[model samples]
Target chain A: MAGKKLSIIVFSGTVDKLMPVGILASGAAASGYEVNLFFTFWGLNAISKNGMQAQPQVDKNYEQMGPMMMKRMMDMKFPMWHQMVREAKEVGEVKVYACSTTMEFFGLKKEDLADFVDDVVGVATFLDRAEGGTTLFI
Target chain B: MSQEAKIAKTLDVKGMYCPGPVMETAKAIKQINVGEVLEVLATDPAAKPDIEAWARRTGHQILDIQQQGGVTRILVKRAK
Candidate 1:
């Protein structure tokens, strides 16, 4: 698994969708795989420094259950979604990338993103790094 | 039912979810020397299979695994 890669395109900003991105990235990293996360559209919101501190937003359909789920996770002392990705980075080769187009759309600069973000890149650059790897769009 | 190997570290990851146990195990194993044992105690129901998969992929050796009450005890030896 030396050269194995796991690439994820994060398109959703909801906590529900973001949870798996963190889990999968951590799991793959733990297994000695190279992990890449490409944040775009609403998903780019999550990497924003401010967004990282904001209250987690869930899908409208799960709005009622969101509070209960968050409570249970807190009671269990589970790490937040972004925290998991952070841990993955600490454990292995994990890179976080923000979409350049989305950055322009949201008027976000490199300084606006979380410190964990590696770079601001376009689709071509993302695809180049994601080539021949297992890519997931969330 | 037999004797267990001496453990170099004990990671108590109780109450964590799926990837937590595996991630902690990966990090914990690195802290120990090669051929040493790292014992992992987890409450997550998925810990057994998840850790097993992690060991298989990372080339670590699982010396033993036992489940009792709600906790799963996994003894993993660092292979590399």
Candidate 2:
């Protein structure tokens, strides 16, 4: 066993937060920790293969806050969020589980999602793996 | 220690989050070989948890880590 095994429960719909989830998981994979990331609710965007999307904070002013902000951040060398996720798969053995309950509601399947998903599991299955470890609700 | 022995390389990865720090650490660790070590400095607030997690899954050895000035410096040894 390592120092501590950690689990993160993601419930966000935006790809931005989901991107970080991958990065965090990647970092754990790199560090040699056992990380189980549970995707529930809107967090499934992380494994969406058809195309992942994120909406920036809308600027009500007469400025191009959305595009400008995105460009500025990109110009500043913010790594493409998706690249972090892709690299995570390459560098480590990460186990990504989708919420079976949520998938049932959405009528989604492993084949329907991107190739990154490890498996589809229910809350009890996730809890079984997450026993006696740190659980993060993101 | 060889003349070219690593004194220490502190990589500050604060604003860059998640895989950013993880990927950066990977590249940095790659530059050095087995004997040499890498000192990772991060301020992402999630660095400790993330790095510790990376260590467990990757089979790499972490020499030590210390926090000062709100930055955690992780010393990692590349495993053969």
Candidate 3:
């Protein structure tokens, strides 16, 4: 059977939201699904070279628990969100895209993004890649 | 369990969680030849169901699934 595809629109930069993006991508890829991740807004910022190394942030509602959650994840030896995405790419067809409009709005260049980003794209390209597939806005 | 099948590889994903066991199993299946069996030993509660779903979706065959203590053992045959 031809593998189904999963399209995720990453709009949040918070670790809480990003973690699900990584986990879902890996889960779909493991089930032989092609994954398309469109990073926009804060999501695009989070994938930037500097953002990749920056301290993880949780939603304001969970701000107090963020440190404890991070510590627990670390103690459990859980892979970082980006690391999970990388592992997903290794097993199946997973493509990560950074929104060009977001980059321009932030005065960011392609070189400023993470190495795992497959390309800088526009909404049209993302829609084209995401057509006829399961789509999620995160 | 009925037929005696030879396992070509054994993947230990005991400490991994969620997609880890499934991802590892998918990668390991590629390392073996077609029709060769891949045995996955995982402790993740999701491993068995996730791997079973992966096998069904990828055209692979699940030969056996056995759980002992907290460990789950899965035997998968690569179809392609």
Q: DockQ each candidate and list the results.
A: 0.84, 0.36, 0.76
* Candidate 1 Cα misplacement greater than 4 A, ranges: B1-3
Docking quality band of candidate 2, CAPRI definitions:
acceptable
Each candidate's clash count: 0, 14, 0
Clashing pairs in 3: none
Model 3 lDDT per residue over A3-78, tens place: 5899999999999999999999988897889999999999999999899989998999999999999998888788
After TM-score superposition, the amount by which residue A57's alpha carbon in candidate 3 deviates from its true location, in angstroms, is 0.6
Candidate fnat values, all: 0.91, 0.52, 0.67
Instruction: Put down candidate 3 lDDT per residue, B1-80, tens digits, no spaces.
Output: 64758989999999988778888888899999999999899999999888988898899999999998999999999999
Q: What docking tier does model 3 reach? A: medium
Tens-digit lDDT track for model 2 on A110-135? 88776767888988989988888788
- Score each candidate by Cα lDDT: 0.93, 0.69, 0.92
- Per residue, candidate 1 scores C-alpha lDDT tens digits across B1-80 of 43699999999999888798999999999999999999999999999999998998899999899998999999999999
lDDT of 2 by residue, B1-80 (tens): 22233534666686776567776787677677776678888877777776776666666677777787877878878775
Cα error of candidate 1 at position A54, Å:
2.2
Number of the candidate with higher TM-score, 1 or 2: 1
